[model samples]
Target: MLGRRATILSFDLDYPALYYPADSGSLAGQRRFVRATRVRLFALFAAALGGAWSWRAGSFDLFGLLGFVAFAIALGAATYLQATDPARSWYEARTASESIKTLTWRYIVGGDPFPLSLPETAAEKLLRARLAAVIDPDKLPAPSPSAPTKQITDRMRSVRASSFEDRRAAYRDGRIEDQRGWYARKAVANERLKQTFTWVAIALELAGFVGAAFKAFGQVDVDLLGVFSAAAAGLAAWTQARSYADNQRAYSRNAYELGLIADELDGVSKADWPRFVDEAENAISTEHTQWRAAKGLGAPRQRNAASAPES
Candidate 1:
């Protein structure tokens, strides 16, 4: 219900949905959903191919028939279980503001306001400024003024309640922009995945060709359709893998920012601050490396100051 309320109020520019502990708490639910989806898709694809093979061969193999039946059964059962579960329905009843709960936790865990090394996008900065303005300075529970944590928590809760999605639209846009930066910066990982999968797809295609050649030479019976099916599946998997890499990079960048925030909130001793500063420098240096990589290819024209932080 709280999450639902948040979702409704999220439209207002004053409040952005806070992060919820969805990663650790509700991750199992998400994983189950993903697993079921993958299984259903794989089964459907395989069954369709089997059906076509049955027509072409003018016969059906018992194993292939059972595979198709089993897949259908699993898909039906998973869908029924998800749809009929009362708990699932109840969970869905909550408002989208639930994310605010998660974001609050990040603050409590000492996440930085935002990492300085990776400056927030212009849109992000604007969204943050807007949210900061709506927050009444007097309403803020003083962190060091002997006020209870619950007091501050409740005020944040109130803000969440009043927020509309419009207030958060720009923040979401900032997140999307940050995602693009991370993807572009992490192109090496993307390239590696591409190269790896390209080789795998090439290997599968070559093997399929070899099987076709063997059939032509009468070495053994072969279904050219099956050969094509395997090769196509390989190529499709390669494409999906590249997409996964992009998602991974986004997650990595978000995690890094959150960790930096946490470090600042924790208020490390002066002696330890140097090490933290060094880490920040390394991250900034890597960004420079990424920029240099793009120099020959019409590199970005950054508006920020070019001066590097004093080490």
Candidate 2:
């Protein structure tokens, strides 16, 4: 086995209990962070350009047309990255969960041969030696085994079955986490969207003011254009405020899910740990119920919310 003594990474004693591995997981996190930053920069650029054009055009009607285009492009980028990088997300999630699993497993199954937790310093040399004695380098558990023989067949089958269950649970958690992150990102975009709308509203209101002044001075046609411009300013302001409220509600729901996941991770040693697997299954069912409720809610108010743009 090609191996070196593993160094202990820093630990977060917070509720979530994040554990950093001094291995490949750390590098993967840095890489993901860099990629997300780049994508956000691109979205910001598109939003800025769209905002500027809508302001210059002096028509509230045009705002919707341009904003949708920008939103589509940014959303497309996010969707593509997520679809292509599912495993990366899985690894990231597993990184945290795996650390907890190792610690909790040791706590559950006593007389642990391997190190229960990574040792931090030379002073922990005794712990290092203890861990090394039981560290089985040649038999790392994975989703599947490469070679199947009679000797390893039963163990491999057990691993495969456990892997499937783990994957299913992990996927459920990932879906909720992704929803949380997406709602957060959407809130950020909504802030920018509101700002864009505010600027346009201000510009339109100013143009309307100018038009009224010009009409007083007998300059140009100030009929429907002037009236609609004033209305647009008020309408934009109302929509921004309403959307902000909706966004807050959406974020609250997502935050709840995130907290649930973090709690589940931290309490791996709870007497009711395996019950979490059952809870996860129930949670999936609960989500389906919530979706149906939302659909029912929309069915009645669809036309009303559509007209008001408050949905």
Candidate 3:
């Protein structure tokens, strides 16, 4: 059992069929949202620059025309965003993908609500129901034509059928350790991004202040105060949309909690493993819960932890 790999197939047409498409949709939607936001902000800056140029050059026909064009572009971008609602797609797809992933982990690792003691048929049925519950039919993407159709892959069964020690090892290494490391890395990345954007916004604001002071004192001919202020406002909007600081805090806290949970794995006995796994899963779920809350997603579906059955 130790010689066999415990990894789940990414191309398996079961839960992954649902998972992959939702994940892709979420990424695509996120990219779209970011691109639209950037375009709008850039247009706004361009409009401000054109206005400043028009004022300095005393040519309303040229620079004023450019400002009007830029304003039109910004309006178009805003209309596109409002019509498509990419942010909503990003959030909904992400929510579906995460919910499916958590259910898959629980099913594979013989975690609560899908314990080893349950008959295979019953467990499979429960898993299917849970998967169906998390996703809306309208949002469910079509499965790839070439993908395999097995929900419970041979590898998942192999891991499930392994000795208690092997299963414990597999779950610890594959799930807990992987998640802890991922959260730790994300925490650092988000913190760095937050700091970078924060500094950029501050720098823009400072430049805007200096430009305004210069204009007031007649030290500079060009009116760049509006340009700098518009740019600063754009940066502030992007930073707020990203929520980098909130993510950094949540990821750091989750990583620390997972570390504490990992330490307790070795002490868990066969009979206690189910409950322990549930606890660890709940710890992971907490981060997702916090994420949903931050996104203004009211609440996720309620799933009570099943009592651990005798091993």
lDDT of 3 by residue, 1-311 (tens): 11122243222223434566677777888999999998998998888888887443454557778789999999999999999888878888888888877777787778887788988878877776676667765654455676445656666677677788878877778778888988999999999999999898889888988998998999987787888988888888888888899999999999999999899888998888878888888899898888888888867753342323323
Question: For model 2, where is the 10-residue window of minimal lDDT?
Answer: 302-311
Estimated TM-score for each candidate:
0.38, 0.34, 0.88
Candidate 2 lDDT over 68-175, as tens digits, reads 675677676567656656334433333333333333222222213212232223213332232233223322222123322121123222322344345333433443
Residue 160 lDDT in model 2? 22
lDDT of 1 by residue, 230-294 (tens): 54683565366235454445445654664453446235543443354344334433433343343
Lowest lDDT block of 10, candidate 3:
1-10
- What is model 3's C-alpha RMSD? 4.9
Off by over 4 Å in 2: 1-160, 163-173, 224-245, 268-311
TM-score of 2: 0.34
The residue-level lDDT of candidate 3 at 209 comes to: 89
lDDT, candidate 2, equals 0.41
